[model samples]
Target: MISNAAKAQPRGASRPKGLETAARVRKAALKRFAASGYAAVSMREIAADVGVRPGALYNHFPTKQDILKDLMLSHMADLLQAWDSADFPEKMDPLERFVRFHIRYHLEKTDEVFISYMELRNLEPDNFDLVEAERRRYEAILTGILQDGAARGRYAVTEPKVATRAIIAMLTGIPNWYREGGRLAKHDIEDIYLELARKAVAPGATPPLTGDRMT
Candidate 1:
């Protein structure tokens, strides 16, 4: 039998020193890229942000584009993993589960979301294709969900792919204007968007009880 200490540990529990430094580099680069556009940020600036020398930063990432690609790829991977692990009651509406999950996940990852959407132009052609492919994999999840609902007569969606893009655009746009201490709490915003998303697909669905409705 395997010993308790032999059990697999959670991520980052016993990562190597080099990997830890790399993680810091990613975090610093993410903040810098999100604050100023990727073109405006530099390897030296990222090194400064990580409290490491330029050479040390280079040891982990050969180029700024590498860092950006890593960030984007990792973001997509994490999003996919999260959705796979998300728990909801079997009776929950699939669309509702997706809306809530998307809203909540993106809200917590505003910085990653911001850079992922805003910095697509900065990636090199090869890198762009790689990231875009991962993005499509994510989009396909919603498309499949929409198609299933439409087939079940639960959603009135005529074009699952098009509706998938539109719904994602609407959901992902929240971070652009959302503030932590805003008039509406995070859940409040989720409630409103949930209603909008439901109505957009499920004709005649009653609006959610979000007291202050969007005009």
Candidate 2:
């Protein structure tokens, strides 16, 4: 779990203030998305949830589609920015740092990730293409980690791309399945997935990026 102290001040991360109300709309969109999925949500319904008359919503976003597009596009931009700014210590072992990055991401932004993936089909072709490009960029980072670790002999993987997708799918699936006030704590899920991802990418033995010298 991200500490409360870190939430207020992301060192390199900031967003526009006028976006706060629009953010409320996005929050409703996310909940509606989780419950009924995207197609069922309408601009009027979203505006109502935001406590404004339906037409007032157009002042912020011209169309239902526009709001959806902004939700997705902004989400991708925020994610990439956060990822690009994190101070994961380079001195840490490769495999541990790799898993820790994903854990931190999942803990901090799981809802946004879940909403982004689930509502992707709602995007128009051009908009979808834009988000997909950003998604591919993030995927490249993860796959690069896998390939680098494999090359360094710190891990074993037959298919880095496929393995990377599996790990992401497993982690992304958590928001959809996790109960809010239920049995397991959030960190339990985090620890389980970190180890699960390690095993999936390199099973049955210890990963030794720290111990073995890198060639």
TM-score of each: 0.86, 0.74
TM-score of 1: 0.86
Q: Determine the backbone clash count of candidate 1.
A: 0
By TM-score, the best candidate is 1
Error of 2 at 186 (Å): 3.5
Task: Note the residue pairs that clash in candidate 1.
Answer: none
Number of the top-ranking candidate, with lDDT as the measure = 1
Model 2, residue pairs in steric clash? none
lDDT (0 to 1) per candidate: 0.91, 0.75
